[model samples]
Target chain A: MSKEFFTIGALLYKDYDLIDVNATLRLLGSLKDNFNIITITQTGEHVKSYTPQVANYINYNFENCPDFDILFIPGGIGTKYELENPVFLDFIKERAPRVKYVLTVCTGSGLVAKTGLLDGKKATTNKQFWDWMTSNGPNVLWVKKARWVVDGKFYTSSGVSAGMDMALGFISDVFGREAADEIAITAEYEWHDNPHWDPFAERIFGKNI
Target chain B: MSKEFFTIGALLYKDYDLIDVNATLRLLGSLKDNFNIITITQTGEHVKSYTPQVANYINYNFENCPDFDILFIPGGIGTKYELENPVFLDFIKERAPRVKYVLTVCTGSGLVAKTGLLDGKKATTNKQFWDWMTSNGPNVLWVKKARWVVDGKFYTSSGVSAGMDMALGFISDVFGREAADEIAITAEYEWHDNPHWDPFAERIFGKNI
Candidate 1:
């Protein structure tokens, strides 16, 4: 609300889930006047996603990255590898508190959790990797039955396509419900508007899908 | 079935729908042993999506593109510009018939329609642009009620997110219903199981979604 347009710094790494970044960010980027999006890779000029192997063009390296209003963290098979990375962890530690909102998709919570940023906050991640989710944030309250969890400025989604739904929630919070619905309708997406009901979680916990 | 792996030659132009290509193909690409996906652009080393400005690394250009088992076509604001390009049209005309299956997403039907291969085939495209769909292929049996149409070897989806549903249908056709369902579950996607009932189409035609 303070800025004319929110600047989003999307931190991506090798083997990141393709849909997690694109589908979610695509919706946020739809509101051109309200958001400015950019991609940042730790040290590489480019990064390749885990499966189907799509290459992404990196906007800025970590060293020269611009300050952003929102920090967009995407989960991947790759984030686990960067857990102990001093520069990566340092970057999150430094920037997470300054940003107005921190939106994470899937294993992105894993990264932020490792930084001890979500120590007492509620979060969630890819239900398929429930063990990975639990292991990442020992001190954090991890909700297993939600499509996404929002505790203060941090929002974490379940997995893959759930990111898009979470992004819509963000849009609804920043923009309006009408704006979110219009986007979901335009995308032709069957938006799971409810953040609490997660079929993946239910199925994982031996309940009916 | 003859080959060890099904090679997918994805034809993408500038400003091609990001989610249409990534979301649909990402699932296909998930079955690593069954699929071999590659990007084919129209004379560019890299192509950018319409919004969120994601850049795609092109594998091969039109002149020296490789032949594959399936031909993937994605629609965007950019496809309309290539309607008359001989090489693009020729690529479709040549490969479409030779391939086992030809899958098109959103406005991709518009590009393929111009090539005249879909003249007598039952096709569907993005319902948002009804005029563009109708104008591109007058002779084609354009279905306004379906999310996706499968006529012979040609498969055309209604619009952006509909592509993911159509791709799952393709998986079910090639693999099995169980295989498609598993992928949908893994992606954590809210799969629209029934393609015959397209709410987007109905909504566009003045019905409730």
Candidate 2:
């Protein structure tokens, strides 16, 4: 509607991981005029992060949130409660299929998994909570040694800050490698462009687990 | 205080850089129990980020903000106006001397420079806005080839995400390298440990410039 900007709906809940949410959005927001990022919460108010006592002001409730091209879900300790929420799951289940892209950071995949959207989908999540997340979707093809896994419109990534790298990769996918590289360079961030360049899997899950 | 947590006073204005503020805080916040981060705004209400329309709820105002162990300043388009505001400059000038560490990301160094806090000290700023930031600090010695510059308590980093590397370096300085490494691994982020490992200098500004 406004220019040709793609609307990105960023869902928030109590105790949501701050870094997981911001890191990804920073890259997307870098293309400012090309993207419109909005904060979505159940109450359409403010929600505190998992730690450090940071809060984000929400712009929309699930019922009133405008149609978005991309749907973003970030994971945190609050996700333990959110995963069981029928309203949360139902909202995602109903909206995700209609979105152009659905992205989940960290254990956010588990939230999507609970909605049955990630069933039979290839995905990867925060390695720290690997067992819990993988078990949530028994039918989903879980890849361990991946920074992120992209299957069709569903893009799932590893832990908190890993979302930034995955966002850059997503940018590379939709835009070009040059555009992604330019953003990373402008931000003075090193782009781990290779999706297979994950050392945390073996380091966290042990040699063979 | 509650436990042995170090307090961080984060200054916010109308259009502060979001990534520059959040990236460093994410790393420091990872060690949640050890640090207490507080947002300080002009009116103790909320501040918007320079981006795709985002905002942050504030914790304290300039008049009520408590003593902090570390003082953090981030740059943005709003900084163009903040540089001339005496209240902003006066607060930083007064508090910076008593703080254990003063970290400035990107053109945030320009704000500190205007306060004369960084005068005759080694500092760095965003490569893209190098000329503008350096011009603000006539007496400050600016380094071109640095991911970050640490001259005493002042940690002035290159740009947005370079603040994360500086934060890790600060962690290694305060805690230990092992602790910083552990945090990095947990976040699934690659830490650029070396303070002088900045390729952006040569990239943004050609060699022999």
Candidate 3:
């Protein structure tokens, strides 16, 4: 039997690039077979893809969204616009309780944090705008030194690739270390004992210290 | 003046799932200003946001695409079919010479290898198919231990998130380490100084030693 999963992207249609956005979708979809994943968008349009599976689009117009075992919110520059939209925030707030996992990549955490669900919860963002993220959602424990953070029901990653780690991390948490290990092995990831830090970073930042 | 940069995806039809594809594209687009990136599809269709960028949708079916400074190809199950197409192989061979860089994510490396570009070069792929990757492309050094591998002009990364690393790695190679460092810092990734390797692989197959 295949496990069911859904990943919702908060695409606001502002100057966002297509590479990273598409990258996140592809990585999450890698979980297919074991998990049936679909895309959620706010514009209520059918997403066209050269590959149709990647085009399985869902519209979120403040009224309907399929029940997702895992609700993912990927970030973009438009996240700034999303943060201020109450309808989107309200939609997230309503669904927050139903999902087994609440995940965010890059600045997507900022949008969910705005819903007040992450208040007092440890979270993270792209780090380029940590100050802005903290100011936007002051109630959560903002972890600065992290590639991704896991606190209770919320799993937030630092930036683009971190989202993949967050997805793998969630799979590990729910299915067991073996599943995560297989995925990582298949993906050729080093599988950081801790996804939070690495020596290359120390080489770069250690200098400042 | 803004730098003239663009990203291209091998838009194979009817395979990839929207969740991972769109999320990756969206997040990558958010990095446009940083990379000075614009994106065009294989059919010469420019992509705008999560939708196609070109209006005419002229479908300029070039025998081989015109030159660009950077070219990126993403993989899905469809890549297996793509591997058998000689036209795609010729197309990659024709366009590769003119581009400043060639990059791929996941199994998309199969396409790159099919072009014979990485025959004797060091490379990697989605972990599950490392053996197939090695068999398909002879003399290709299997850096089975790396999440991503950079062999001179040819750069290949392990499945999924490794693409993010490849993108950032390509940016660093072209723009300089400083630019890559800034991007890594902004993204909050440590730059996995050592490519991701499974510690157990060495021990599990100790006889190879």
Clashing residue pairs in all predictions, respectively, total: 0, 0, 42
The numbered model that scores best in lDDT is 2
Candidate 2 wrong stretches, greater than 4 Å: A1-4, A205-209, B1-4, B206-209
- Please give the distance, in angstroms, between residue A156's alpha carbon in candidate 1 and its true position after superposition: 0.7
Residues A136-163, model 3: lDDT tens digits: 7888888766767899878888766566
How would you encode candidate 1's per-residue C-alpha lDDT over B1-209 as one tens digit per residue?
A: 31347888889887788788888888777676788788888785687787655766678888888779899998877877788688888989888989988999999998889888899889999888878767988999898888889999899998888998998888888888888899899888877878787888788786643
| CAPRI-style class, candidate 1 | medium
- Tell me the spans in candidate 3 whose CA falls farther than 4 Å from its real position: A1-28, A45-64, A120-122, A141-152, A193-209, B1-67, B117-127, B139-152, B193-209
What are the candidates' individual DockQ scores?
Answer: 0.65, 0.73, 0.23
Quote the true-contact fraction of every model: 0.62, 0.76, 0.27
Which residue window of length 10 is worst by lDDT in model 1 chain A? A1-10
Q: List, residue by residue over A1-209, the lDDT tens digit for candidate 2.
A: 12456889999999898778877898888888789889999878788886687777688998889999999999888899988888988889888988999999998999998887888889999898899988889989899988888999999999888889899998888877888998999888888888887889989767775
The 10-residue segment with the lowest total lDDT in model 2 chain B? B1-10
DockQ of 2: 0.73
Per-residue CA lDDT of model 1 for A1-209, tens digit only, reads 31357889999888888788888888887776788888898885687887665666678888889899999999878877778687888889999999999999988898999889999999998888888767878999998888899999999999889998999999888788998998888887878899987988888886743
Rank by DockQ (best first): 2, 1, 3
